[model samples]
Target chain A: MRAKTSAALNRSELEEELRAIGRRRYHDRHPFHELLHNGQLGRGQVQAWALNRFYYQRSIPKKDAALISRADSAELRRVWRQRLADHDGDEPGHGGIARWLNLCAAVGLERRKVESLDGLLPATRFAVDAYVHFVREKSLLEAVASSLTELFAPDIIADRMRGMLAHYDFVSNEAMAYFDRRLTEAPRDVDFALEWVLERAETVEQQESVLDALRFKCDVLWAQLDALYHAYVDPGHIPPGAFAPQDESTDRPRRYR
Target chain B: MRAKTSAALNRSELEEELRAIGRRRYHDRHPFHELLHNGQLGRGQVQAWALNRFYYQRSIPKKDAALISRADSAELRRVWRQRLADHDGDEPGHGGIARWLNLCAAVGLERRKVESLDGLLPATRFAVDAYVHFVREKSLLEAVASSLTELFAPDIIADRMRGMLAHYDFVSNEAMAYFDRRLTEAPRDVDFALEWVLERAETVEQQESVLDALRFKCDVLWAQLDALYHAYVDPGHIPPGAFAPQDESTDRPRRYR
Candidate 1:
């Protein structure tokens, strides 16, 4: 029976703020996603997305592993350990990263080209690196709170899975198995993180910091799409030494071993 | 003396490589500066430049202090201590940073606004933070070598001092005093660092590291101007929550207390 006060937000109030953040700031709201989902994007554009996203996908396990290393509680470790397992899997040729590479191959990018990362946009690298560094450098609560973007993730993943499959013939059910898994994993992860954050963020200052970390994560995600839209969409201001799509056509689906 | 192979560059060759890096990569060559120095930029652009460059100027004392804290030799400390004095000065009103704030005031930006840094572009902050991190984290010779951007600085400063004053009525000989001082200070500082680096970068690996450091520092500077150019000059995409110039006209010059 808690009443909301200016001193601090009750759980529901904090939840509302977090939801409002996702509503306003999520990459799901980015025009790139709108174009991406509706099949309006070129094949080269799709390939560019797959290629750049592989960097984020590959880095997730490392980010999760960094978080796990700093976890003081076994309960926290138990919940977070699943992130590493989900991302890294038990052995080689498995897990989300491998599936992402498969998507890259399906989208017609050479697997080695994505993995080498020599063609990454500086904006992509900086935005992603800033996230990893934020998690490593900020307080544990802030680190854990940053992942609350997952609170908004299930919807984006669903939209992406549905829209990408519908719009792009090059995309297939197999290329999207990654999202199917995320649909389940994200909700569970978000629930655990949400409950953990709500319980721990008792003070108004802590609540604000938690909220700000979520907003920061949203900016990180949004900036990636902004870079993509700028480079691939209007104005096409491709910086020097980033991956250049061969031509302005949709890539045919290809299988890679 | 070691013959020039894949292995080692002799002193003069290393100097040439460092200078060559400056020739190719310095921010002086950035299109932003081309517009800035040619008087092609509007007053808003000049004001934006002053506001952002303040972040770099104020950070100098802290950067120099970080390097000094790591220096192993008394001679190094004595020379480096002068950098501290030059930026921070003996008292509050005297140093390079204070002069920079005065310039900011002269350019019609609120000095308080520049000092608060709430108006800074994300790109400016990240680039400068990366430099501070590099100096704090890298080897001493590499840290010292990174400042070797100063080796190229005197020329840029002289050109800037002449060009800015020649072009902008708001800019005067007194307002130009900081660059004048830097013209004298940079060469002396660079000569000390260059000799220290050449004499001590005894291995090819160390030499390469020093060269890479100088290159990294160049990137730091070039990236800042790229942000300014992108936001102020060309596509004019100012990021959300950065300082927005009130009007396109050059600000009427004003002096500060």
Candidate 2:
């Protein structure tokens, strides 16, 4: 844990501390990622990941909209508005969520099932909704700081794109389009957010909230994977009403294999 | 999944459906509970459960307060006020939270650490906070329906009390007082809330929402155990900065035994 210091950190010091949290707490460090990246995950496992992840992907525009709704200045709103357009797109069946659904479809899930989110792990909904609620209700600076997870996202996205392509025949260039787009989109978004947070978080307590906000976001991401690993990986016992792999028995016998 | 029926059911049918949800989805059925009630967990695991559960215990009054804030009638507010009193007590160190702290003390956790919630699992915070937000934000019928899980609580509390007292040497009657108290409190609370829900949820859509709300609350409880089971039980990898057992190396090596 970063020592709970009362003193305010300098620009670089705060940035370093944020990066350290990413190194330690980001979901990229989660073991499920190792399984996912290395292609040790079965096809159904990958499908479950995509299907559940689609909830997070789909919530981006909503979360961004919530943040935009809370933005005080036109410049801040203007900067954040790009997120909505990027995620929701200018026209029907475009943008990140559409691309994500396409990815889910490529993984063999039906379009309607993915859209309805009928099969989602309730834990996934809880975590993602918590993120959106955090942005909408917390102080705007803390809201902006929550998005700093994007500062670390590009690397994980790149690693995911490379790993999925090499190990899984089911994954294709088109299927990985969501991450490909994020590679460019995330950096642009993070640059403005990081600068805004660094400039605005002037006091020690504000700086700590900034750091804690990022930590909360990391937990949001990491907890999703933990749920996946528990339900679909080791000791797999998919919760009642969650997505069970089609080929597997729906009984979800609770034994560690 | 309770087949999503569009047709409104009679009172008895709705009640039966609600009870069926509890049968299938209550956190009491979670494996972590089986482990807990059966005394399969180590002391550190038990401590982790209490420390994490304390977050949920502390939030009950806030949730009731939110519900009361939204209530349109004096009777509703007056009835809900009792929950606040039960949890928060008349003064400092007097309510259910204080009693919970004593339980935590019985399990050997520090009062300061428990109060600060410094050692809490981030997932625990996320799940608990989601429940509070649901009550604050969702339609009042849904909020009232969410408490219907209390309909199932007395049995679980009874089992928990019996099992903990019989299985764990560290436990005492006084330590179990919170559950002992909850057994009476939950049934009384559920009686009023369930009757209110049965009366208010008049439309088919609203009835469906009531069932869904209970499902959501069960997920809230079950997700907490999922976090605990993942971090303290199988394939344990305590996330960075969460409470790690003192006897265990803080490194929290990821391999499952």
Q: Could you tell me every candidate's TM-score relative to the true structure?
A: 0.84, 0.95
Alpha-carbon runs more than 4 Å astray in model 2: A1-6, A248-257, B1-6, B248-257
Per residue, candidate 1 scores C-alpha lDDT tens digits across A1-257 of 13335689899998898888888777788778999988898887788788878888888877887888898999998899999889887998788888888888888888888899866766665567677877888888999999999988887888888898988888889988888888899999999999999999999888888987887787777667766766676556455445677664444422110
For every prediction, compared with the true complex, DockQ reads 0.20, 0.77
Tell me, what's the RMSD of every candidate? 5.9, 2.4
What range of 10 consecutive residues in model 1 chain B has the weakest lDDT sum? B248-257
Q: What is candidate 2's lDDT per residue for B1-257, written digit by digit as tens?
A: 44556568899889998999999999899999999988897778888999999999999888999999999899999999999999999999888999999999999889899999997998898889999999988999999999999999998999999999999988999999899889889999999999999988777888889999999999999989988988888878788788887554453533333
User: Isolated chain A: TM-score per model?
Assistant: 0.93, 0.95
Residue B21 CA displacement from its true place in model 1, Å: 2.5
Cα lDDT tens digits, model 1, B1-257, are: 23345678789998988898888877788777877778887677798999899899988778889999998789899999999899888998898998898888877788777888866876666667677877888899889999999988877787888788889988888887788889889999988999999998878888888887887788778767766765676556565556777663445422110
Q: Ignoring the other chain, what TM-score does chain B have in each prediction?
A: 0.93, 0.95
